[model samples]
Target: MENNEILLKPAMSFAVLKILPLIFLALLFLLLAWYLSPFFVFFSIGTLAAGWYRLLYIRKSIYLVTPEVVRISRGIFFKRTDMLEIYRVKDYVITQSFILQLLGLMNLTLKSTDAENPVIWMVGIPESDVIDTIRDYVQEARKHNRIYEIN
Candidate 1:
């Protein structure tokens, strides 16, 4: 209800974090301006465009928990909102690629036990630690069978 009562965690963006190369390339282009090659301008523009997309993609990557379910929401192009009852969860998986592992990020997949539809996956979680946090929340929700409130 109140901002003070909510856990406002940091929103991590792979775009922002992974922009080191773009920044370097932009700088390199500027530094090598004397040469004035078309490639330099192209690279510089490309880097800026990428950085711009990433910046717009930024959001409050967060999952809010209540007494019933877990509500996870995030995205840049397609805003996602997942609401799953803790009891319906059949399996929980956490995966990290080589690049993600190096960057300390992970993807979380939640499988529900329902017959027709049963799988939900969230990508680019920005931090590997969210797996633990989400797992712990699931456990607690299961213990009490709580429902989540979605915004």
Candidate 2:
């Protein structure tokens, strides 16, 4: 059908969970700077830099589900893009942890036949019918490709 229809773009806020420890350490360093040597301020800056790096990495990731394939592009300095043919998709699972539920986000994991990247996780996806859409597309692709599951 059409080429590259955008499917899901996860929110950058997903990085919050990943970078939370760095942020906490940065705050601690800041507190230390207030009482101890000013050099602790530099440590705080370093932690913040690390957090910023993680934020950019998450912000740059994209998940696209097309009629024939699923495209996942991720990275900041070294970008890598992966494509999983929809016909190769075997199953999918959606999960929402307690913190993710509170943030109104969920994770979508796709199981594929591709040997190199069999499992792909789409995190921080906003709550919606995304799984349904992907499932529909997977079926359509399988039909179009004449793919059948023997087992």
Candidate 3:
């Protein structure tokens, strides 16, 4: 956390894809409960709970990019944090699906030398200059550490 310069949080749009279906199902169940049996009310409650869980899970994720390392923190009940040295970053890719493009969000995938999590995906990031900022930091960190990729 030394001089951490940038912090990125996934947009709530990340949960839309996942929760949308659940929401529809919940409404369907509610309609069925209103017209048919009361047991469907329980199903509606369950679907709503699942949607809520997904929202909380997505909301809890955070990404921090520092000059020396990238920190990823995610979890709902049990928090887990991972750090990838900026110098270890080998490559990165930005992907935008049709829905994400419509939402003005993109996913960033980073290939790094970290053994535990070599490929990290940061989803629902806004379409912005974050990639350029990270690239600059990675270059600076590699130069400062005197680290060079062979291939």
Candidate 4:
């Protein structure tokens, strides 16, 4: 296996849920467009396409924690990938809503010194051993990279 193997593929449920309101709006547009001219069909299609693109983008989101780096890949037709060296990782915070707590899911935000992408957000991760494993890997990577603070 690759050393940079994927550590977690987070659930898309959170992303889908987050966009439900927009999806409802899109549905409303479709209904309105149906009563309107056929030209509005194009508008409805555009709305639906945008909504699907959002869902697909969230679905493609992946969180990867290797010994040396943390990576997030997200997007639909246009893909984006962000990587933060583990040694640059300063801290991480895990947040959960009441519903998320009930569902045993949490969102993790990583803070790093990386200039371009200093903050990394990962949602729908199981709040258990995965967090610990990531922490351990960050520590190990810092050690391996000989990263230390003078103070």
Candidate 5:
């Protein structure tokens, strides 16, 4: 069996999945404001604009999905990378708050056996299939002990 050690990150545009719900809630406020006195319009506009910025940020936060691992990298001044080995992974978890559930989005956590440490989270995975695919690959890595690349 090959050793599996790598990082997996959320797919690009995942950030959009997060900002969208806020936009909706903001819209709700805007509507309420319009009903009351139009003062809430600014809040709605600001939320929409921020959501659009998130969409653009989502355009940039790309992920590298490989056979043995997934890599998340972004930013020029504060570039960062996270790695998680498939073999080291212990289980999979999908979480969503009431708002996230309402938005049809979720956060996928790849939990390792390290009890003292926190699990790695891939936030804002919109599609259930995307989460499933990741779980499948992680399982496959465990099943065959797939070798992974760190890059």
Candidate 6:
């Protein structure tokens, strides 16, 4: 694929903590329904369905990092593909919340020159090595594309 050589293909998964609130709410509903009636089973099932749906969406997300560009394809029904030229990536930040840190997950936020989608976030990357690889690729791409900034 020449310039389209795939540098890193990272999976986008939702952290367990991110979905904890949904599970908690589902349990709460189940408890409340326990006192009311057996109809609460429906709410429990609905909660499970919602959680599964969210997971399915994340599973469907695609993140491809190449020397020339970064691509993200997301959404289930109405799919979307966002591309950011590697040369236009201004800076990137790797962040991990307390829960994410505990789970060994990280979020990579890339700030690019693209005005429409200046900020691109790739979350739930399972390893720190992926972050380092992305950083190196972005730097290499910038050099390859002769991108420079003067402060």
Write model 4 residue lDDT over 84-141, tens digit each, in one string.
Answer: 8877877879999997887778888888888998898888876676667777887788
Candidate with better lDDT, 3 vs 6: 3
Question: How do the predictions measure up, each by TM-score?
Answer: 0.52, 0.91, 0.92, 0.80, 0.51, 0.80
Over 4 Å off, model 4 = 1-6, 33-42
lDDT tens readout by residue for model 3, 1-151: 4554788778987777768999999999999999999999999999999999889888889999888878999999999999999888888899999999999999999998889889999989888888888899989998898888886
Question: Rank by lDDT, descending?
Answer: 3, 2, 4, 6, 5, 1
**For each candidate, what is the lDDT?**
0.63, 0.87, 0.89, 0.77, 0.64, 0.74
lDDT per residue for candidate 6 within 1-151, as digits (tens), equals 5564543323433434456677888898899788988888789889878887777677776778876778899888899998888778777788988866766777788898899789998877765566556677777877877777788
Score candidate 1 by TM-score against the native. Answer: 0.52
Error of 6 at 124 (Å): 1.0
Count of residue pairs whose backbone atoms collide, per candidate = 6, 0, 0, 0, 6, 0
Off by over 4 Å in 5: 1-60, 113-118, 146-151
lDDT (10s digit) by residue, model 5, range 24-127: 97889788897897878888888888777766655555455555666666553466766555466666788888867776667777777545334766676564
Candidate 4 yields a Cα-based lDDT of: 0.77
Candidate 4 lowest-lDDT run of ten: 1-10
- Report the lDDT of model 4 for residue 69: 77
The residue-level lDDT of candidate 3 at 106 comes to 93
Which candidate comes out best when scored by lDDT? 3
Could you give me the TM-score of model 6 versus the true structure? 0.80
Clashing pairs in 5: 6-84, 6-85, 7-70, 7-83, 7-84, 8-70
lDDT, candidate 2, residue 66? 83
User: How close to the true structure is residue 79 of candidate 3, measured as C-alpha lDDT?
Assistant: 93
